[model samples]
Target: MSINFEALDLRAFLAVAEAGSFRAAADALALSQPALSRRIQRLEGLVGGPLLERTTRRVALTALGRELMPLVRRLLDEADSGLFGLRGAAGRGARVTLACVPTAAFYFLPAVIARFTEQLPEVRFRILDLSATEGLDAVSRGEADFGINFLGASDAAVSFDPLLEDPFVLACRRDHPLAAQARVDWADLQPYRLVTVGRESGNRILLETALARENVRMRWFYEVTHLSTSLGLVEAGLGVSVLPRLATPQGEHPIIVTRPITPRVTRTIGIVARRGRPLAPAAQRFRELLIETWADKVLADKVSVDRPRP
Candidate 1:
């Protein structure tokens, strides 16, 4: 004869074994007394012996039941732990973790994140506001599911997907001479003392590389650690600054204005992920949202720039 048992049988037996009375066990398990009895009977049948000794007012375990008690308790304990572990893993997956450059985090990513979260109210986000190189490292080191940053030299462990080209633009005080022009060339900036980000910044490296290739040079009178800080300097009539178009203030800042530069140079931003690794469902969904929204924004920017201004 073969012996078989189900989780329900073990659970019922454990509940009855621990509660000390059928009525108490039935109440605890949220089952009728008769149903609880039936479950114990099924387990007893498989065991081929009486497991519980029932009296008019109390219940006691047989010798066989005592032997099986510890084993059944261990099995149930392990099962519960495994189920809880799986639940924890699922909870972690419900949130998307993305590493993004400060430029994207400031101007491009927030709107897309708002739209993505609206459709997934249960989903959450952990945004790592890192620099281009740091963002790349986050994804490559498995600290983030994906990253949005410039197309820099990446390791063999990661792959890149081009997203958008953010061109460098000139930012100046509203009443400055360059603000009235439709566009100013790099050569046109020669006369101005420029406020630029420090050499430590990836933006500075990009500017240096592009300028070296174009064979252009400019005098940098003030250096700041952050692009936003450069804007303040420009606003105070210190000097003009060249920064990514995305870094420019979006709304009308009466003290500041931005203009495109001739012989435009752009930094290509992209998505970075560990090679051959798949994104969690939430991360993949957010990635799709980023791509779609980016397309709309690029088109809109082009249309706005092409429109004739009064």
Candidate 2:
């Protein structure tokens, strides 16, 4: 049967079912008992079924009532979510929470954030520096609006969209022998002590997997938490480390040289958001800014100038 339902009446039904008495439901709904009873009666007439088995002492759902309750609850929940989403969209000036890998924060996020601030001065940002796994978790848990992480071929409860691919480079002291080479292979790295990021880091994992494929091994001198720390160790001639090209600071350091690794390896960086969930307006605006900045400043410049004029 075709039935038109009012949200207020549905709310009344839910309250009666939960409170188990018309008086209690009316009190909870902030309506008189007679008004509440009239709402329930109107709803029951529309559905053409006795929803609740009511008596002088108690109230309980009939078989049809039990069947209809779940659908009514779902309808109310969807309506509430829709209203909340619309309100959030209307309040476009709200702050956005973004989580990202530390390296992305250091090397990639700054320029995007600067551009975003210039355009959307009224918008606020809350940034969290987390590892790839932690960043993914934050997005999945609804703690972050979006996350920047290293992309890989794995199925998780979040949606990932590749933004850029940054190649790996070998960083070492300027005086080190390998620094002078035009290009170095994995085997050439075997002699030097490696000051690497922790194995759990996405960068380290990619590097290790590539090295394993080539059957190349190096002496592990140290493991550090931050890329800057590893760069510092490499600059001090403590060891050489493989780092993303973007993470390598520009200009000459007193003791550091950066070189491309032959048979180049790269990591995919991407934007991650909760799967099957809509993004808030602020978050969507921030994401657009991120992509625009990356495309214009980072990816566009990195393209080869020698390629046939396209």
Candidate 3:
């Protein structure tokens, strides 16, 4: 006798096996308890074996069900993968979910997206703006296809590809005493109140490490989360800040000015993904676009200087 097991039946079987009761599985699957029971019965009949042992108060999977669990999971995963592959082959386009640090979303992603969309208009993008740490977690959990964050050694389950080296710069009001100087030293900044991104940020860690080496004790007047807010506070003369040069807004923001910090500090921005996983075609294309755009547009115009230089 030929037997056919539908996707819905397999899903119902898995739900029932996991939940241990038709009522619980029904709630989980959003189906009626009777409907779920029927699906499991149909599944067991198709397999020519009893899949579960049921009593008044409980349910438990039989030996055959226990043995089939792994195969069922693999079948589900493979089915989804096969469907995705077919979609790509048919040119239906693929969706990529990208998680990124807020600064990258504010500064780097716009240009890269403009170039990417120009080439692959059919593809869609879902962007998650997260903190550096959170973005890294999202990629590792497979919640996102890939992520862009500060370059640092991540969990062994994750891998990174360096994209750009962005330097930290001092930002102050235009009429501030240090604004007119070519560059300002760490000592000169000590006298002023400092506004900066919060300590949780990777940028903050880099700044703190540099200051620690020099034994500098700078006063922080404000520790804000957003780059734009930090710049706003500086423009209002509340304090000066060290921010990534890339994150500096292009247009004039009242009296705000950005100047290179004399003893240069820099951070590497990179792409991160699951260590052993293959990227979907759309995600791979987007990654390539980001690298190409950074090289052709952003990096080409920069003055080459050794990093962490004084």
**Candidates' TM-scores?**
0.65, 0.64, 0.65
Cα RMSD to the true fold for all candidates: 11.1, 14.9, 16.8
**Candidate 3 steric clashes:** 0
The list of candidate 2 runs beyond 4 A from truth reads: 1-93, 296-310
Return the TM-score for candidate 1, rounded to 2 decimals.
0.65
Count residue pairs with overlapping backbones in model 1: 0
- Model 3, residue 221: distance off in Å is 1.7
Q: Encode model 3's per-residue lDDT on 33-113: one tens digit a residue.
A: 889889998988888898888997989889999887888888988998999778665334667899988778767677777
Q: Which ten residues in a row have the lowest lDDT in candidate 1?
A: 300-309
The lDDT for every candidate, in the order shown, is 0.83, 0.81, 0.80
lDDT (tens digit, per residue) of candidate 1 on 58-113: 78999999999999999989999998777555544498888888888876677887
- The backbone clash count of each candidate, in order, is 0, 0, 0
What does candidate 2's lDDT look like per residue over 222-241, in tens digits? 99988889998887778899
Question: Over the full model, what C-alpha lDDT does candidate 3 score relative to the true structure?
Answer: 0.80
| Model 3 stretches astray by more than 4 angstroms | 1-93, 296-310
